[model samples]
Target: MIRPATPNDAPAAIQLLFLAMEDIARKISGTNDMQVVTHIFEHLFREPGNQYSFENTLLYDAGNGVAGMIVGYDGGKLHQLRKPVLDYIRWQTGAGVCPEDETQAGEFYLDSIAVAPGNQGKGIGGQLIDAAVARAAGEGMRKAGLLVSTDNPAAQRLYERMGFKVEYTMPFAGGRYHHLIKKIDNA
Candidate 1:
């Protein structure tokens, strides 16, 4: 059952996100940096007016845990290609980097879609995507997009099966990343 996330669900949401990120890191770089991952997750809940939103849906396990998550937002103005280059070198020269050809206007970003490890292979991911699509349509968004790490083939396959196409691929942070876009009718 998908429902809106409230402020109380912040801890569970962060846990689900961490699980998903661990899976991604293991699949991509073959490393599990829990410290950095935890910091990022903590920062999201700590920061005020963060870019990402988690009120769309939060998958309950029906027992005592969260099985997955589907997070998206009206990311029409968040995609800037030169954000990394300028924000990094100018401010923090040795800071972390992201995809170089960032987002452009009119793109609603599907920031993250993750399912728990134990609950995977059971069509939960598909359901999350469907929920996100429905929400995007309801919000009258123009196009939905996301950045998938090129090393994560499982996620890439899942996104492709859900009508997301690879608009372009580029190198970033010593690795490859794919910018996937899905055009949806905002009518």
Candidate 2:
């Protein structure tokens, strides 16, 4: 069952996010230490309206615990909470990490999606993507977007199958990423 993430899901959600985006998290935190990353995530998860907040996450609970989660927000509003997030990271990690230019204006950005390694290949990722897109459309967004690392062709193909097309390519986290977008037909 997929549902909105609650504060109680913070630990699991953060773990899933770290698993999916550990490279980026490590880059941002300036340390590969997950304890530092978890500290940063814990701060952001409790703060409403920020990118990593629980308010912006949706979880897939597969009977036992959180099997997966998707985090997203409006592209235009993305910067509203940037300063605080960066400040928190800087304070904790001793240096601030540069934010990646991942989303475009006027789109609902699907920030991160991750399924437990043991639970993958079971269509949980696709369900999370579909649910995120539907939530974006329901919020009256015209498009939905996400970044797929160039190294991950399987993920890219999954996005392609879901009707997303490459809008552009950009350098991110010392690697190239394809920014994919899908038009959300709210009607």
Candidate 3:
């Protein structure tokens, strides 16, 4: 079942974020950087007013004992000038891996959408994305956007199939990693 996440869901959301990040990092860097990344992601994405605001969603797979989550941000005009520069510094410092870009196609931002490894390939991800878009549209957003790691083509293809188009790609300091964005119209 898909549901809107409340503040009470923070703990579970943090836990899930940790699990998802560890899984991805193991696949990508294979280092012990997951904890650091997860902590930063949780703080920046969930802790509103620090720099931005987000509307997060959670999916419960009662029958399969799994849960999925989607985190979306408002991306107000303030972010255009502030966030990209901040992200650039963070990326340079090896504190994070996000592209510094300004998106005008959407008022809402889907930061990260993750499904438990054990329950992947069951369409839970699509459901979560759909729900998030609906919520954003309901809130008067004309479009939605998200970023995916460029190395993860499987996820990029999935987003493309869902009508997301790549907007930009920025290489990490190592030049081996990149972040890609896809913009979707709610209308």
Candidate 4:
């Protein structure tokens, strides 16, 4: 069962999100401190307008609890909610990290997707990707995009199989990432 994430899902969603983007999180926070990162994530995930807010997340539930999650947002509106989130991160981490140039304009940006460690290989990740794309199309977006680390060949392959083509390579989160985009067919 895939559903929109609720405030109550913050803990679970944060866990998976941190698991998936630990390196990126650390880069932004300027600390490898798990506690600080977790604190920042908790605040961000519970807040209303930020990129990682519950409003922008979806959870895959497999009976017991949240088994997976996908976080994304409209690229055009990406900066509208930036100040508050950045303020919160700075307050919590004492590091003012600027947003990376990750998504192209007018696209739906898939920020992060992760299944619980034990839940991988069960198709939850793919389902979440499909759901994210469908959500983008439903919102009238013309394309969907995401970044895959250059070293993460498995994920890059998955995106390729889903019809995403690498549009360019961008430096992000202390490493190079392939920015992939897929046209969203509304029909």
Q: Can you give the TM-score per candidate against the true fold?
A: 0.71, 0.96, 0.64, 0.96
Off by over 4 Å in 4: none
Ranking by lDDT: 2, 4, 1, 3
lDDT of each: 0.62, 0.88, 0.58, 0.88
The clash number for model 2 is: 0
What shift in Å separates residue 112 of candidate 3 from its native position after superposition? 0.7
lDDT tens digits, residue span 60-132, model 2: 9998999999998888887775667778888888876776778867899999999999999999999999999
**Full-model lDDT, candidate 2:** 0.88
State the lDDT at 27 in candidate 4.
73
Q: Which portions of model 2 miss their true places by more than 4 Å? A: none
Query: Which residue pairs in candidate 2 have backbone atoms (N, alpha carbon, C) closer than 3 angstroms, thus clashing?
Result: none
lDDT string for model 3 (1-187, tens) is 8876655556566666555344443332223565654445455545444322234455554455447877665667535433542563365344433434434444566655777777789888899888878877777787777666666889888988987777667543333323334444554
Q: How many backbone clashes does every candidate have?
A: 2, 0, 0, 0
lDDT of 1 by residue, 21-125 (tens): 555433222235665444444444443344433443445453566787866766654543224323432352234334343465666666667777788898887
Off by over 4 Å in 1: 22-40, 46-48, 56-63, 79-101
